[model samples]
Target chain A: MTPATPRRRGRPSRTESADTPAARDRILAAAREEFSERGYDKTSVRGIAKAAGVDSALVHHYFGTKEQVFEAAITLSFAPAMEAPRTVEEGPLDGVGERLTRFIFGVWENPATRKPLLAIVRSAVNNEAAAAVFRRIIVTQVLRRIADRLDVPDAELRAELAAAQLVGIAMLRYVIKVEPLASADPEQIIKRVAPVVQAHLTGPGL
Target chain B: MTPATPRRRGRPSRTESADTPAARDRILAAAREEFSERGYDKTSVRGIAKAAGVDSALVHHYFGTKEQVFEAAITLSFAPAMEAPRTVEEGPLDGVGERLTRFIFGVWENPATRKPLLAIVRSAVNNEAAAAVFRRIIVTQVLRRIADRLDVPDAELRAELAAAQLVGIAMLRYVIKVEPLASADPEQIIKRVAPVVQAHLTGPGL
Candidate 1:
């Protein structure tokens, strides 16, 4: 439907078009576009609703708030990488580093996934609100799982330290596109960085 | 002088205010504020000149281009952290990791340096031009020096891997403000992270 189409006066029930899967997907896609283009600070719920050709109430009805919408959008975008927690569960702890690194980088290696991730990073870097949303999702969904599975001293910190290593190279290789790191063969980076990740998660104190 | 002030009838000689250190500093300061507020894609040399109450010509005269102005601004802001290369050289190879990590974290620990660094990172993540400028200066000045000092195979990649680990934590703790990692004691973080950094720089194969 066109944005010029007027919303019906009454609130639609759960069975109505507003609650349909297609409509929800449309709203989410628009939210991602708005977030990527306008960033978190400038984008508004009303704007997202308008872009999606729905009334603002429908957006609030589905997503609750702008931050909720952002969380949903990022969660969807991070779906591929979200498997990381489970990846940790599938392997022995000794090889968890390689498994996690390969899983994370494998997601990044695909251009389809990388585009939305780039958007997420750009938004997170520039706005605290966006960053908070990002941190909550990642820490809750990704890091906490890894930390929980690993029975070790400083488990939480160790998990985060491992994350920091992966996140750092992602920024350099993908976001900033720094040379050598940016263009180096994927296997080479995986080979080099995995050991550091392994150390952070399992190695004893320095 | 105000922005409304007309240019002098002709170009001022090298001895004039345009070439003076104060004028140059004003232009650089204005450039930083502009870049921080507007980001690289939206910031213009003309706008920087207007903010500094000088003709755009003088911005070019002092710093060549918008990219050049950004280079100068980041270089100045990064002055404290720039000692990293020298820090690498000051100690024995075994301790280089802790020395570099402490020195880099020391720069980040101070709010005065951290504020501008946050701006630089925000700009770099959002804009390719800014990222390129950031990459060039960082590689040429910081990472390259560290790589040059290390007589390892794939020395450049090793240096970048070391850098990636540092850059990642900075993004998480400072920019994204990821919890636990964000709130953890600084020395504690340095203690854990330094060893991984040491590995990336000097350790053997995985």
Candidate 2:
């Protein structure tokens, strides 16, 4: 073998990149569709790879395992919850309810966020792994930060209560597609529901 | 030859009796347990019969099909919505909010009601048939009655809005088990949440 000769990798033909973000996104999109349509128990890694137009080996390379893929999907869907604390931190504490409401509505209303959110909701209801991921995200990243910032006793409780209310509304309006709620104007919902959420977040009483 | 023998089929065997309400209840209870644990798709007549300690033939005799069994199970669970109109009708319109709240909280808080309710919720989230049944009950029995009683221009909208808020709260507390909201005392919940529910039910402004 010539020392100066460049060694070529096997099967280096069309579109061979070192695991680009675009490939990861494509895999995620395909995974969401697979999970949503076929459910967690039914969807397979090879199926996700075929849908994503990537090699089955590449999927394992990127995500490690189907469980890890699912975790990635869940974490991707709940990215907003991670950002919510920072957003809350920047806003006035006095109107935390309003700010929280608007932020939640804004994220949920956006198509980019809503699709993954729908996936998360559906997965959480159907899959224990998805639910555990959701619980961890909500407890650690979302509620913990909000609770820490709260100045009242039982702040954690209040934060969770507030989360329940907000998430419950999202569940009805978005996932369940409950008619009038699904059709209700975002502004109208925010106006009516924000105060209740606000009260739970920072209001008086146990 | 059978006619000559006069084969007895009057009330049928105790295990096969379909006319008795106890048989109906047992079948329904089994359906609830099977549907809750396995979901609607995985639950079957044989599974329900196995759980109920009866033959599949007896299950079919009592309820025509799996769909019928599911219907019966749902009706049994959702009977409270039927009674809601009657209960709300007995009280003044102004107090409807408080009465409705108390009734809802009572139903959800009761083990008798909660189990079937949970079954319905799980089925609705997972199965199309169950969702249809849930939608029908809400629109006809629950929302229609409430909307008819309201003088608001968007009475239907208001009724649905009220449902969304209450159902949302229930979803979080019962299904998702979201921390404090899940564990909060029913009295404390009612005291704080009833007013918001009341506002949605009969508050000023559409």
Q: In candidate 2, which residue pairs get closer than 3 Å at backbone N, Cα or C atoms, i.e. clash?
A: none
Per-residue accuracy of model 1 over A70-163 as CA lDDT, tens digit each:
9999999988888998988887999988899999999999999988888899888877778889999998998888999898768888888889
Best by lDDT: 1
DockQ (Cα-based) for each candidate: 0.48, 0.24
Clashes in model 1: which pairs? none
Residue B166: error of model 2 in Å? Answer: 2.8
Question: Which residues of candidate 2, in runs, are more than 4 Å off?
Answer: A1-31, A44-68, B1-34, B44-69, B85-87, B92-98
Candidate 2's iRMSD: 8.9
lDDT of 2 by residue, A1-206 (tens): 00221212343323754377878888887777777666666678987877777778888988988878887877776887578777667878888887888898999999988877776676676666667667777778888889888877788777776776677677667756667778889998888777777887778774
Best by TM-score: 1
- Model 2, span B1-206: residue lDDT tens: 00121212344466565546777777788887777667777789987876666678889988989988888878777897567766567878778777887888889989888877877776777676777777777678877788888867777767766666677678667766667778888877777666666777778773
Which residue window of length 10 is worst by lDDT in model 1 chain A? A1-10
Q: After superposition, how far is residue B153 of candidate 1 from its true place, in Å?
A: 3.3
